[model samples]
Target: MSRFAGRFSGRRAVITGGASGLGKAVAARMVAEGGQVVLWDLDQALLDKAVEEVGALRGVALDVSDPVQVAAAAATAQAALGGVDILVASAGITGATVPVTEFPLDNWKRVIDINLNGVFYCCRELAPLMLAGGYGRIVNVASVAGKEGNPNASAYSASKAGVIGFTKSLGKELAGTGVMVNALTPAAFETPIFLQMPQSQIDYMKSKIPMGRFGQVEENAAMICFMASEECSFTTAATFDTSGGRTTF
Candidate 1:
């Protein structure tokens, strides 16, 4: 709430996949707290709507899965924001929900490209800017499914696991550089990402949470905001769990 007021004064942030769901929620909070944010997503229409709704600096539509597009978008963002102080690599997807043997080859690759590689591209292109500025915070949105792989969601699980690993590696590389990197591993949240899943799978995930309910977008945004803030300093190559007692490790 108002507690975040002025916390991000004069800060510039970029949220990949900010068109909706957790990304949008994070963007809104950043702006509300005096941060200027650029929203990135694949859907042009939704991107426009979110930018308007969130009062972001602007919205850029690009496929996070494409390295070339990601590179260009990063350039555009750097130019637009005059140098990003924070990066929230939240762009991702939940691929087909089927047994590993039944998972489509195309689906697996697509999920990995967006959920994992997309994060790398964002961090790769932006971390240097933070280093140059001598300050930065990177929050990569992963999932509990990575820690404990969910059945029939091999691609999503694998991609998120990669994210967790990547965050650790990047954190070590940026240690003591005023650039902190961390991963957020959350259980199922009632976001649009759930639309891609089967009801059975959704029920299965809910059952895993001790809270017996899905996380709210605001709840997710709260943890992410802290991770992306100066308050999160001294923590890197680590994961912040928000799984409602489902994952203690």
Candidate 2:
């Protein structure tokens, strides 16, 4: 596992939502390969636990949905980490599963604010630092539901779709720069985020994946690590699919 020790040596990374799920997996992978990682999450206890387990990782707790907080945290990260070489915008939420017409207005806004706007806020604040450093990798965690809309999860789907679009636009804007922006579209995964979804919705998602199983966090971390590595130079403004054949398009 430490075979790729030099792959991320001397690199500093920021992983939002790094306290758990796919984000935690990616953070662990980065650290295992010799990178310095700073985890950002809204849960103080989880952040503390992740830092304890990851060892040497710096954890910052803040709501990514707040632009002001994100900006301030990014500044602190620059000072603490010296400069950010990689950013994995992994923070998100799965709002209520009710139909669009019945979807509570508050729920819709909450999902959009966290899932979509939070990503924008992170990129908005951190991209400049990357631009100054002249070397950066940005991987945005989107979902298969974003491409193939899932019934009863309109807000989650829409927010992720916006993430994909935003990645494409930002990738192009930073084309000639050292920054590479891309998104990962994963199929259903058995993460705690499922707690937010209805049972029927979860079963429906599982049935759609041709593999007949949900994705593993490690599987996603592998793909993410590659995308965030120096080896991923030629690709940008694109979406990487980890959907187990659910999205061949």
For all candidates, the clash counts are 0, 0
> Highest lDDT: which candidate?
1
User: How high is the lDDT of residue 190 in model 2?
Assistant: 79
Give model 2 RMSD, 1 decimal: 0.9
lDDT of 1 by residue, 15-130 (tens): 99999999999999999999999999999999999999989999999998898998899999999999999999999999999999898999999999999999998999999989
Cα error of candidate 2 at position 63, Å: 0.4
Cα displacement (angstroms), candidate 2, residue 8, comes to: 0.8
State TM-scores per candidate.
0.99, 0.98
In candidate 1, stretches whose alpha carbon ends up further than 4 angstroms from where it belongs are none
Worst 10 residues of 2 by lDDT: 50-59
Question: Any idea what lDDT model 1 has?
Answer: 0.94
Report RMSD (Å) for each prediction in the order shown. 0.8, 0.9
